[model samples]
Target: MAAFIIRRLLQSVLVLGFMSLLVFVGVYAIGNPVDILISPQADQADMARAIAALGLDQPLWQQYLIFLKQALSGDLGRSFAYSIPAIQLILERIPATLELALTATGIAVLLGIPLGLWAGLAPDSWPGKLIMTGSILGFSLPTFWVGLMLIMLFAVELGWLPSGGRGPTTELFGIPVSFLSWEGIRHLILPAVNLALFKLALIIRLARAGTREALLQDYVKFARAKGLSEARVVCVHVAKNIMIPIVTVIGLEFGSVIAFAVVTESIFAWPGMGKLLIDSINVLDRPVIVAYLMVIVSLFILINLAVDIIYSLLDPRVRIGEAKT
Candidate 1:
């Protein structure tokens, strides 16, 4: 298990390096750095200083090496637009985005699993057919449109919740709180539901398919023949077996939840890395853009590693050479 983990970690490092190179090349290919310095008014001395400041005077290979070294050390350079350390800016925004993603994922899993189990158990029933049909439509709907509908129904029409932002502007229990408080949970409802709707649909379908397959297996039949109660057979024998594939799907979807939350954040005015990345891109803020990209790539690799470890624990057969056990 240790060796497997180490091997995966090494592979992730290589992948990140390749990703960084691709981002660097893509950004540089878009325009020359000198153009950014002399667009409005051309001044020879100013141009020379700007070129030196940005390391444009250095060889391309040397500049890339410097960037790599600084990035590895967590420098991430200063934001060309913000005039602040890029890493610091991203770090400040991390909590809000992480909170939103985590909240949405929890809602998705809680709602999706039970619906899936019911649909699978009663595949021919009206409730089951309805659930399946609804899930398909939910999965096919665009996220931005879903967010808009939620805003209209919950915020504008109903007036049951705030239109946008994280929370009410107030304090609780003598403590100052922003949109991140318990009162703020109401604000999170629309955005979280919007973000989770698609994932919930996918998870429900996957879970239903997995449970149906497990129910058809020989072990399930044997459990029934052994005089076990139907509920016990389904819960202990069938559910356990179905978990392997469900775990895989859940992990992949959870990773995607974080990756795709950017658009949802934008629509709902939620402060997160996704919105920050989009804003940075619009301004052509290279430092912020590169920093955000690195953070996202790192997260993707980390989530996959976590999934692999969870898989090993859930199924011993997945452990390296563990089939011999």
Candidate 2:
């Protein structure tokens, strides 16, 4: 297990190094730094000063080494447009995005798993058909469009919730809170649901398929023949076996949710890293862009690592180098 973990960590480092190289190359390929340094009214001395300030006068290798050093030291530098520390800006907005992603993921798992189990256990039944239909619609619909429709129905037409923003300005239970208020919750509901829709569909489909496969296995047949209760056969016997694949999907989806929050956040005017990244990109803010990219890549790698560890835990055969059949 320790060897496996260490190996994975080393691979993660290599992946990060390669990812950094790709980002640097891509950003540099977009345009020359000279364009940014030279304005219409700038003179020779002004251009030279700007070039020196940005370290554009240095060789490409030297510039890359300096950037790498600063990044390693957790100094992501200042945003070219905002004139603020890139790391600081990202840290400030991270909480909202994390909250949204977690909330949506939780909703997806909670709703998707039970529905999936039901559908899988009763494959040809009406409830199974309904679950399948819902999953299909969810997978087919775009998140942004779903969000818009939700807002239109729940916020505008019904007038039950605010169309956008975090929450109201008030106290709840003697705590200074807004999102806890009814209006705030109403505003959050649609966006959260929209975010969860696709994830829910994926989970349900994976779960149903896994359950079906598990139910057909010889071990499940043996359990049934042994006269174990149907619930025990399904929940304890089948569900446990189905978890490995479901865990993989959940982890991947969770990682995607972090980076993919941009569009949803934009639609709802939610203050998050997604909005910050978009804003930085619009203004060609290198520091902010780089920082956002690093955060996202790191999160993705970490999630996959966690998934690997989880797989080992769920199936001891994985830890022992036994091939998965």
Candidate 3:
């Protein structure tokens, strides 16, 4: 396990190094920030000062080298727009995004797995068909349109929930969270539900497929033949085997939820990293853009690493020593 982890860490470093180059170059090529950042009314002296201050005066390769050096020391530099360290800015918004992503994923797993198991256990039943139909619709619908419909129905028409915003939060271990208060939960529901639809649908399908496959296995039949209770047979024998793949998907998808919550955040006006990223992109805030991408890349790597470890533990066949090579 130690050698496996070491090998994976080495691979992750290489991936991050390559990705940093690609992300830096891509952001650089996306039109200069100076044109928008510096007013046309500014004098040459002012322009020169601004350019030099932003380090845009340096060559591209030199700028990247400097960024690489600063990044190594955990200094991702100041945002051209926010006038603050980009990493600090991103971290400030992380709690909101993390809360949102976790809530959404929780909804997916809690509801989806049971429904999927039921459907897989009895595909011809009315309730099973209904669940399957709902999953299909969840898969088919576009996120933006669903978000709009939800806002209109819940916030505008029914007045049951707040349309947007994170409402209120209290600190837990110095991190602000909405799930602590009832009012905060009311505010979280619409957007969290909106964000969860697609993921929930995916989990449902995966769980259903895995359950069906697990039911056909010899172990399941053996369990039944051994006079094990049906619930124990299904829940313990079947569910455990099914969860191996689902856990992996859920881990990776959690990272994606964090990275791509921009649409949901934008629609709901949620104060999260996704919204910050969109704002940064509008003015070509290169530091924030690059910093955000790098942070996301790091998160993906970390999540992947955690998932790999979990996968190995869950399934003994995934040989750690053999995979290290």
**Best lDDT among the predictions, by candidate number:** 3
Q: What tens digits encode model 3's per-residue C-alpha lDDT throughout 1-325?
A: 7887899889988998899899999999999898899998999899889999999999999999999999999998899987999999999999999999999999999999999999999989999999999999999999999999999999999999999999999999999999999999998998899999999999999999999999999999999999999999999999988889999999999999999999999999999999999999999999899999999998999999899888877877885666543
Predictions ranked by lDDT, top down?
3, 2, 1
Which model is ahead, 1 or 2, in terms of TM-score?
A: 1
TM-score of 2: 0.89
Question: On residues 1-325, what C-alpha lDDT tens digit does candidate 1 reach at each position?
Answer: 7788799999999999999888877776666646653566868888888779877788767877889999888788788767899888888777667677777888878888878888998999999999999899889999999899988998899999887777653444543334456678887788888888888898789779978988898988899899999889877776676677767877787777776788899999987788888888766677788888888888888888888888777777876646483
What is the alpha-carbon RMSD of candidate 1 to the true structure? 3.1
Maximum-TM-score candidate: 3
lDDT of 1 at 223: 90
Question: TM-score for all predictions?
Answer: 0.90, 0.89, 0.97
- Say which prediction, candidate 1 or candidate 3, comes out ahead on lDDT: 3
Listed per model in order, the count of residue pairs whose N, CA or C atoms clash below 3 Å is: 1, 0, 0
Order by TM-score, highest first: 3, 1, 2
| Worst 10-residue lDDT window, candidate 2 | 169-178
